[model samples]
Target: MDLYFMGTNAGVPSLERNVTSLALRLLDERRSFWLFDCGEGTQHQILRSPLKLSKLENVFITHLHGDHLFGLPGLISSRAYQGGDTPLTIYGPQGLKRYITTVLELSESRINYKMDIVEHDGGTVFEDESFRVEAALLDHRIPSYGYRIIEKDQPGKLDTALLKKYGISPGPLYGKLKRGESVQAPNDKTVHAAEVLGKSKKGRIVTILGDTRPCPAALELAKDADVLVHESTFLHELAGIAHTYHHSTARQAAEAAKYAGVKELFLTHFSSRYKNNEQMDRIQQEAEAIFKDTTLAVEHVLYPVDR
Candidate 1:
């Protein structure tokens, strides 16, 4: 799995950053890409990368803020033009259905694909065979939420050497054994699958937070995550402003990462005041001072999940 930052700016678009949009690419996994937010010009951002818009199966919106969801209507309309026929599911807070329905009604946009919109009340939002997504309320100016994505553990690989040692030749029987099934051999002997398989591999955990101040709910949602993607709208020097605006400072995000036991911290949703990347580097340095495994999120950068 990999995370691609399409936009990193907090409130509005700047020359350096767009808005708040992220794409969770799962090419090698069971599902396709799952988008966290759909900020303005999100389709244009995807065009710059190798991502296919049709493969976007799920979209999770943190809030109704323009920076987080302004690109949804346009992207949905554009998908029809791009010949997207697969079904797409969208999960978000209340009023999401009304918002999208109003947009579609006013614009007369006809989507060629099936659209499933789920209005959540802030808890465990979604769960499939591959992953579980949970949401928690945060201390934002608006009703924002933070999401935690926990991937399911994968089954262990089958030990071919052990199977061969048991006089089991490679064939459909090997497939059954790999699936944890007890099968009878040609000599009418029972072979157990657990004895020949390796230990199961642990799954990866990724937590993505929306705009919010330092809150206990956010920390709880991001506990022990492999990567914690938190918004840092201000520098440590402007922490007072961050608190007033219901946003987090770089140092605050780092502290949250440390408290949550996150392995890596990705600071994003930068304020528009900083035009150059140097300010981001400085913010990263300040965060790294608190938590060593911290970095500033950049647009179009893909971060791989080290599972």
Candidate 2:
């Protein structure tokens, strides 16, 4: 799995960064992509990347903030125009359904595909054989949320050499073996799948949070995650401002990553104050002081979520 940060700025668009939107590309795992936020100008940002809006399946909105959701109607409309026929699902707070419905109705936008809008009140929002997603209410000015995506453990590859040694030719039976099923050969020989399979591969965990103060829910959502994407909207000197705005400082984001014991931490939702690369480097350095693995999320950069 990979994470592509479409827009990384905190509130408004700056010369260097846009608002808040992230695409979680699951091509290798699910053959589709899941969006975190669709900030204003988000479609423009995606136009510059390798991502295809046609392959988008789900959008998770953190709150009803304009900066985080203004692009929804435009994207949904564009998806229909771009020949996106597959169904799409959106999960967010209570007002999400009304917001999306109102905009689509007012704009007279008719999407060809089915749109499922889930207004969540926390807990598990989605689950399938491959992944499970849970949401937690975060401490913010509005009813913002944090999501934890857990990928299911996959079965290891089947031992081809072992099958060959048993004089078994590869076929549909190999698939059953890989799934840890026992099969009987035509000669009445019972082949145990587990005996010819390698160890199972562990799944990856990723946590993405919306704008919020340092809260217990953030830590719980990020616990033991492979990568935690949290907002660092301000620097240490302006921590008071961050608190007053119900936002997080660079140090506060790192502290949450450290407490959760995440393998890597990506700090995003940068304040507009950090304009140039040098200024952005300062935010990374300050966060590194607390969690050494912290990294700043550069727009359009694809980060690998490895196990």
Candidate 3:
């Protein structure tokens, strides 16, 4: 899986960055992509990137802020004409349903595709064979949320060499053996799958947070995540401003990443005050001082979740 950042600037768009929006590309796993947030001009950002609107299967909005979801109605309306005939599901806080339906109704837009809006307060968002996503309340100005995506463990690969030693060639028998089932050999002998199976690989965990102050729920949702995408809207010097605005500083974000034991921390939601690249680099340096594996979420960058 890969994270394609559409925009990273907080609040408003600037020459360097837009607002908060990203797409999690799961083309190899599901042949589709999921979007997080839909800030203004998000679709315009997608036009410049390798992401496709037709492959957008799910959208997870963290909050109801204008910077987080002002582009939703426009994007959804445009998705209808972009070969997106598949059903789409959107998950967000309580007021999302009203917001989406209201705008679409007033605009009188025609949607060729089916869409479902899930106004989730907390708890499990959805669970399937491949993944489980859950949400938790975050410390934002509004009732924001953070989502934890837990990928299911994959089965171990079958040992073809060991199976061949048992006088078994690739056939239906291979399927049974792959499932860890005992299979009968051609000579009327029984062979066990465990003797030849390799170790099962553990699943990857990704935590995406909305605008927030460092809180306990953030810690629990981020525990041991492979990737933790948290908002670092301010530097240490402006921490008081961050506190007043219910946002996190670069240092506080690093502390949370270190405490959560995440493999990597991507600091996003940069305030417009940090205009140039030099200022942005300072934010990363501040976080890296504590958690070495910190990255500033640059606009239009594709960050691989794992190598």
User: Among these predicted structures, which one has the highest lDDT?
Assistant: 2
Please, what is the whole-model Cα lDDT of each candidate in the order they appear? 0.90, 0.92, 0.92
Order of the predicted models by TM-score, top scorer first:
2, 1, 3
Candidate 1 lDDT tens digits, 72-172: 99999998776678999999999999999999999998887899999997888899877999999999888999999999897788888877777889899
* Order of candidate numbers by lDDT, starting with the best: 2, 3, 1
Pairs in steric clash, model 3: none
Q: How many backbone clashes does candidate 1 have?
A: 0
Candidate 2 runs further than 4 Å off: 164-172
Stretches off by above 4 angstroms in model 1 are 164-181
What does candidate 2's lDDT look like per residue over 135-216, in tens digits? 9999999999999999999998888887887767789988888778998766678899878889999999999999999999
Q: How many backbone clashes does candidate 3 have?
A: 0
User: How much is the lDDT of residue 280 in candidate 2?
Assistant: 85
Which should have the higher TM-score, number 1 or number 2? 2
lDDT of 1 at 209: 96
